[model samples]
Target: MNTASPTRKPSRIQKRNRKLILDAALEVFSTHGYRGATLDQIATCAGLSKPNILYYFTGKEEIHITLLNGLMDTWLAPMREIDPEGDPLEEILRYVHRKLEMSREFPRESRLFANEIIQGAPRIGPHLEAGLKPLVDETSTLFEGWMAAGKLAQMDARHLIFSIWATTQHYADFAAQVRVLMGEADVEGGARAHLDMMFRRLLRP
Candidate 1:
């Protein structure tokens, strides 16, 4: 009955090779998006043969979907942190920071995800309806409760969530435009102040 393989640590070489593949896939996918990227390009980026790359992942869609699925947990975590018991302003502000940090740390993942949605989210439809919709609904309820208690500025709770998303994700989704207008130095120190001011103004009670 005890026939299951024991959990084993990845060998150092395996870990390095895996990173190589994921890094290469990120670069290719981010540049060309899922529809445009090719397995050959991804393999070249990984310094491996296409067959070798396929060993790590079965095919292009697999790698693309895998990356998106992996990114979702981290993406959803901040929203889950919305504490019903926490001060409303602070709870939302903390959520804002978590989002901003994700933009800064995982801009490529952000872009890839955006590309998927920009294409009508063909791969993530059920996930949006099932996973994200519920979280948004729950969070909206919390926001409504805050408003009823006079804890926040009276506004549409769902729209408030949308606004927070739009503001925080702007840095990643529109990064090239932002850099073009705001310049490269902006991400270094400017984003933090810009976001803080934006949220503070929006959330002022």
Candidate 2:
């Protein structure tokens, strides 16, 4: 009897290098904003030469915009999952949990994009209009369906979504305050509990 494991995947140094550049760019962009960050900083952060970074990407703006565009889909997906056909409170709470999970795992990416939006999203505007707006519209219709069915509380669906996004994203965007106020140990837990309580208050049935 064969007890061997599955086949190994191919090593992809170029792909890995590109990912390194993207990650380093995310950190740099988050900290310094777009105009403030330089190619040398990103190259050093990725431990690659500036030419090498350019070999993978044309420029810093390209990488930043690529990261922003990639993030748009993921950032929009949790809202897309808010099913009008499913249990109302449960669906909304699941979205809340997903957004929190994203905040935990991808804080730097969150900060990078947040920094862009705070400055008016020059690079991300088309992606936001073409990608994110459509998803929000779909989910707004879903929310409207839930409200009309009497499954959810009466509320402006778009504003409800806007508030949920603003509140959940604030945790990561303002993580410094969260740490100072709550201490490091309970930050994640406190966010979870606080979000639950807030949503429950909004969604009481």
RMSD of each: 3.6, 6.9
In model 1, pairs of residues that clash are: none
lDDT score, candidate 2: 0.83
Clash numbers, per candidate: 0, 0
**Clash pairs (backbone) in predicted model 2:** none
Per-residue lDDT over 5-35 for candidate 1, one digit per residue giving the tens place of the 0 to 100 score: 3776666866677678888888888778887
> lDDT of model 1 at residue 106?
86
Question: Per-residue lDDT tens digits of candidate 2, residues 104-179?
Answer: 8888878888888888988888888888888888888888788888788889989988888788888888888877
Strongest candidate by lDDT:
2
lDDT of 2 at 186: 76
